[model samples]
Target: MIPLSGDIGNAKGIIRENLGTVETRRGTTTLKRGFAHMLKNGVVMDVTTVEQAQIAEDAGAVAVMVLDKLPADVRKAGGVARTASIRIIEEIMDSTTIPVMAKCRIGHVYEAQVLDATGVDMIDESEVLTPADEFHHIWKWDFTTPFVNGARNLGEALRRIEEGAAMIRTKGEPGTGNVAEAVIHIKNVNTELRRIKSVYDAGDEQDLISLARELKVSYGLVEETASLGRLPVVNFAAGGISTPADAAYLMTLGCDGIFVGSGIFKSDDAKERAQAVVLATTFWEDPLKVKEAQKMVDERQSMLGLDTKNLELRMQERGSTA
Candidate 1:
């Protein structure tokens, strides 16, 4: 319950006696930390199907994404808000104990709220794929959930962080093959932060965004946000992540984690690609291990489109697709 620290043991006992054991835990870990452990290490697998999700879980993804469509959905559907069916999401969750997340339409808090009640660990207010009625801003503070939102630039990332999103990510255009955009954003955000810091020393308890725009960097936090402890939440580099090298690059660029969709499954080798991405992110400094792991990933992974098309057909059959 209270993370077991100090003489709070005696205090905990008193509180439990007065309130209830359930009340104490509900206040501490469950309510306060909700799914923090689920993403502590931050390796998320973006999958379009149950089979891909199982592979991701087996290959070491801390979490997985299951949706009816990926990038293609974003391009074709005009907006990707609420693209995945509850049935699809539940199927993935049922198959994996690791946490599961799905993308939601922008400004579609209702869809996100539904997933939260369904026991989803996270949601991406994915502007890249969401078909929101307006800008993809969801009032995260109102939800009993932790969410991750995508940003093309640092300004958006900062806004999401301020909005209480537990995670931040780079926008992957759902179906695009290019990995250049994400790489640039990660590099710039980190590089720009250094510039902002040169002008002024951020006070211990000052605003992080002023420092961020001043320092010109984007972190999960702005500096004064959460004590800068191991990153306020998790920051996973997504979009256009193509190979083991790209994964390694992001980790070096200072990503807390990554998510791969078309990059892994779309490759000529799915299992090998998935395994390689995992190995690359987890053991980035070890070249020898990376080399060995390289062999584990399939150089020719399958693309995500194949998987998405199948989901579309199935949804058409049901006539009740999201």
Candidate 2:
């Protein structure tokens, strides 16, 4: 229901007025968040090469995430998964008109710095990579580029938001083509929000303070979240989405958009699956349109799904302590 274009433009206007220059810390933060807002109600696909990036762009992706290995491969390779090669990222940026994003290891500030220097449109402090620091995440507020972090619940989401994340995605079990985890996460966040709103509506200020303590976030942020009834920033669905129905299912659950990693390229028909996912995301409320999108991909060609319960590694659990 949010008018994506108009809202983003207005956010940009506010950013311009607040900082007077786009190069300042506040200005860059505002610009980054505003830019993310522009990608609402769209799909961001993961691509490893220039050709794949082109395929995703042609398939109508609003943005592309550049990665050396897809989530499935990352799970298979089992090593220190670092950022994508600079050359690959640069090539993708050169090839696509849409925004290009890259992932940095959780808590790896230098990797983030290097990606920022490469001029990526956005940086994901991703758990998909083997974490660089077991205890801390990158201090996102220290960087000029906007960052997106994953959350399994409202506490994690708020912690990342407090750390200056411009956007948040549900930390659904990545690398598994199972949507069940994603569904659980979104539901958890929504449920927690409703509870917070009820407390706020009942004028239980002390309970709100208790909630702030439980979530380990600022009282002001807790208050704002309760008042708004959702995260202040754009929230997208990510991780296990592998089909048109999966994409639309999350959209209907109130996510702003989706991130499909290892879903398209890992499938038998990458191009067709990419386009189908985009169409589903755009017209998620229309069941007929969703069906048409589903018809675009052969069920036999979808990525072989892995049961979340059987997976050896759970990327979503990486930042639980933070």
Candidate 3:
């Protein structure tokens, strides 16, 4: 395959790009010829309105996440056993040229199946906030759709990958004006995984599978982490990334991207907050950028006495199902 690396400098309307890859001036990227570049880099906006989508695109986000309601509601409603209106998803997609993604109830295969036909670039099988469903462990073998599932930590992430998820996100639920719990879990997994190779004693693919079964994570998960040498197969640090510093912190940890749900809206100036997030993600390691961006988001959010603990109470009363 001839590399198209040097072509981006100038092109005649992108006559051809990166060998089989196609890029139109309109900003639509097709990754047929080379790597699937949809999920890499930049920010994915979390929005409930079309206006938000426009703001995200202008802010230079690579994608936008659309939801029917805030994450808190999404969790409580997870058992409805149906899909949200495709129009909401379609409208969000139409409103922006950037990639559009939506959240479905956990293990909601029916909803996931419908998303395949929605012209969406990705689907987030989020557990942080999903409508209830009788089924669990959404089987990825059913379709070739590129999926992103929510993970509280490393083990869940590994399983999802084994099941064929194309992406992993912080299980920390978004919305509620607070960061999700999955944030801490991701780091721990990354740490525990340090011993993966040493424990396996053999790098053969089969060895990894045997380890996963022993760890009770997931066989597919073991395969991906062992293969790519990364805990998340294109994992993104999500939830609780309310400020630029938080975004940068995750990126510094080697996250593929950051998903900002309620963080953007929590600020007094939504547009400015969104822009700061995008910039921080691109320049995460730069202390100068993080310091400056934090001032903006920090001042905007009132941290005193903000209680987001109801999610736990509700969960204790209501447990998980298939």
**lDDT, residue 74, candidate 3:** 53
Best by TM-score: 2
User: Over the stretch 1-322, how does candidate 1's per-residue lDDT look in tens digits?
Assistant: 3121111122221223235434432222234234654564356877888999999988888888877765544555653235588888898889998888887766777887787778787777765443555534676655656678776555555566555565677663345555666776676655544544443354433454565655334433454333322234456787767677767777887887788866776677777777788888888878877677676765445353333223332211110111
Clashes of 1: 28
lDDT of candidate 2 over 224-295, digit per residue (tens): 889888888899999899999999999999999999999999999999999999999999999999999999
Better of 2 and 3 by TM-score: 2
**Judged by lDDT, which candidate is best?**
2
Question: Cα lDDT of all candidates, in order?
Answer: 0.61, 0.88, 0.63
Q: After superposition, how far is residue 11 of candidate 1 from its true place, in Å?
A: 25
Instruction: Please provide the root mean square deviation of candidate 2 (C-alpha atoms, Å).
Output: 4.3
- Using all chains and alpha carbons, the TM-scores for the candidates as numbered come to 0.75, 0.92, 0.76
Ten residues in a row with the worst lDDT in model 2? 4-13
Candidate 1 or 3, higher lDDT? Answer: 3
Q: What global local distance difference test value does model 3 have?
A: 0.63
